[model samples]
Target chain A: MARNSSLVFEGRQTQLKPLFPEDVTQEYVSWLKDPGVNEFLEARFKKHTLATQRAYVRGFDQKTKFLWGIFDKKTKKHIGVITLYDIHPMHKYANYGYLIGNKKYWGTGAAQEAIALVFDFAFLKLRIRSISTGAYAPNVASVFNYKKMGLSYQGTFKERLLYKGAFVDQVWYGITRDEWLSRRKKLAF
Target chain B: MSTEERIKSIMADSLEVDRTLIKDNASIYTIAQWDSLQHLRLVMALQEEFGMRFGDREIPDLVSFAAIQEAITKKMKSHGKE
Candidate 1:
């Protein structure tokens, strides 16, 4: 089995399972297209149709990137999406991203659980040296979440991305496997 | 000084927030520095000061200043800190 294949990650107070084919739906795609939802998509993925969402979800696997659908165990509801993208086995690292689409779950530590699980996968299973991520400068929540995950701020790239109609900077953050190992118990999901 | 006083001092310094803002019943998420990373740092700081270690259960329960105080008190008692 691949790392995190059993889809049984214990989050802070919830659980994270692999995103199955069934999780893909027009409803989710509609949310993906909502301006409020895609505000941080960086223009390229801002306007995803159901078909595009389907393709994106279908492509996630051991071959491409790992995607997981976050869930609230107590409420038993889907809370968000998280993925380890740009997985490079040779370099032993990947890019991480997640969004708690259900605003109701925002500020509830559900995202924290999702993030902790991602780190667990990256450091324990993949044996990656480091995981990298960037938050669009305007996405304060994203930046806050990454910082909470113990990622160190690298720098900001001005006009790094074009979203909607204007260019925006992206703030980079990264954490190494050694850091994860040193702080694993404290950051445990 | 009381353990609570020491912890509040630590919070005031590390979180860079007003000590008055911290309440015994406040949620851990209320503080800007009570984040995940800072939570770890807090645990390390507390461990160094109090000469104690925290388990996973203690971590989840240590979500607030009061919670940390409670956990530390419990540990201190069990270890004969008095």
Candidate 2:
């Protein structure tokens, strides 16, 4: 529907942009369905036929879940995905998620750039009061990434997710708008 | 005895690993326990030991021991400790 405008969040050496339908169909779904890639993800979509994939992308755009395709400005490659889901307009808050889907880009701080962009949107544009997210307690990498974005661990949700025949505890974390503004000392220009 | 050795001690302690494993250029990603939370702890430890604080521009860049050393060196030089 193209309801939203193309917004770019620039970092020291990277940039973030909202994902268009074209990019979603071309790359996003394939990346998501990769077994090794989707290991940490809870829901697995079956059989992405041409029609199904197209419909999936369109459906995603229709939701309030804003998805951003992360790119490395230097290489101009689509490295990962990040999203602000479960948006609460009245409360000015959302639940967020991200993944550096590309193995080559892991440990490169590109995810951090994507997160900084989300922070920019939440605090600078949307005026969101808080953003919350949860990670499987065993997913150390995701937990580490969240904390790096200044999110404080709230608590553990015991057996919150059943994945791969086992119930996984979730560690919930969040950062308030006021806390973000106060902690943010660098205005990356 | 040397600046490098002192830095290694700090790294070993902060990372909660063997001193011998902490090379001169070891980074947070290279160590298991040196994740983001530990990263913050390391920064605070350095501040306490050196009696200094880092500005926003430097925190993200302080991922490696070499980077930390450079930051500390710069702070020291600014204070005329070098």
Candidate 3:
């Protein structure tokens, strides 16, 4: 496929395409199993295998839950995954989640760009009203990315997640379509 | 200010540490406040102060004060600012 034609959503540094069962690879399974990579993700709690990943890829409904693989535009390397799930059409809302499986891409703006592309798709194309997400308090990177993208802190579930033999808070964040639109405008200017 | 000093100053301000504590070799692993989030903030500050943008490829390598300074210098030179 042509470079630009293949991308469902293209950002400056990252391109996102719908994930398929064929896209599942041993690397993807390894990312799920890597303790350091999944330190803050719920997936870390479970053992992942190629069969499970293939099944997970086939499980998305496409409407209520959409998954996309993030790729580096320059390298054309699949580095991560992003999903918009738990969609409520009547309420025009959904939940967002993402993981940068490639350690090399961490701390780069790939996560932020991939997220911005997803927000554009959610609010503009799907007409989603609000998008919600959360992160473990100790996962400072996730929390900071959400906040930087203009998601407002909703609340915290105190001692909701157990990590390293102790409890940690889960911080919730939400952004309405209006808020995202305005934020996009500000960023453009 | 020199590029090194300016880089240290931005790192100090972004991470909320004393400028003196921001050594050339200081990095996220070495500085308590220079966590992942603060690292992004520091990157943004450097971009704004130096009037240059860093490609995503450059971000991961820009972990330490010296690395940031070197990157900025190279970018500035490429832009013919140096």
Candidate 4:
């Protein structure tokens, strides 16, 4: 909340606002607890309650990480979260993870719009050299969106993650500041 | 059958819709059954039927029937299958 000098990363259909502790509502906690919504999220491993999430929101290191709530423009309802974390100032890089808790927004270009804002901030404002992220191999829709964001497939860590009952490979993707800049210039956006 | 017709049939089968319904302009926005997850299945179905692979990055552009046909055509031309 403190680091958002602009206070918002506005997109066409969604906006990214600081996800402070007070923003942790019952519905938000429910999304974390929902198995379907959390299947690909690392947070799925831990049982989420209102207290734990609120605490997690409060204790985040704003200097090194940012947690933003992705809200639907029409309802102003929080649909999901996008996080930029593990920022290394000297290296000028960071990693990202996101979730679209509301299934209605899936494949509707909402996530692509919201994540573009993350790139707009991290690469343009922070001057981050590169941003990298990993996705569950089974999550084709998410991986597809990552690719649409111009994050090229970097590599795969075989059986590096656990799913419902067994192991699954995790695929990595990344994009540099220069690459992102060029892609955005060409894209309709 | 032409590759385009084959693709239309595959799309119809994977989504459990009549082939006539999937017009050239039809897309995820128009098809109720072509949800995000179902779209993944459609990709797999098309790949399996065509015996070609699509890059993850190439997926987002294949939202409409025409786009899918164009991609498959481009892929076929690249492989000298057309």
User: Better model by TM-score, 1 or 4?
Assistant: 4
Quality of candidate 1's docking, in CAPRI categories?
incorrect
Error of 3 at B23 (Å): 21
- Where does candidate 4 chain B have its weakest 10-residue lDDT segment? B28-37
Regions of candidate 1 where Cα sits further than 4 Å from its true position:
A1-5, A43-46, B1-82
TM-score of chain A of each: 0.86, 0.86, 0.93, 0.93
Which pairs in model 4 have colliding backbones?
none
lDDT of 2 by residue, B1-82 (tens): 6666776787788767899888876875456456554565676778887888875335645777788888888888999877
Stretch of 10 with least lDDT, candidate 1 chain A? A41-50
| Poorest stretch of ten by lDDT in candidate 3 chain A | A1-10
Task: Report how far off residue A114 is in candidate 4 (Å).
Answer: 0.8
- List the DockQ of the predictions in order: 0.04, 0.08, 0.07, 0.19
Candidate 4 regions exceeding 4 Å error are: A1-5, B8-38, B44-82
Best by TM-score: 4
**Cα lDDT of all candidates, in order?**
0.72, 0.71, 0.81, 0.81
| Highest DockQ against the true fold, candidate | 4
lDDT of 4 at A106: 75
Ranking by TM-score: 4, 3, 2, 1
| Per-residue lDDT of A76 in model 1 | 67
Docking verdict class for candidate 4: incorrect
Candidate 4 lDDT over residue span A1-189, tens digit each = 455657487777898888899889999898888888888887888988899999988866555688889999888989998889988979998999888888787766677777788898999888999999998787778775665677888899999999878898898899999989976764444
Better of 2 and 4 by lDDT: 4
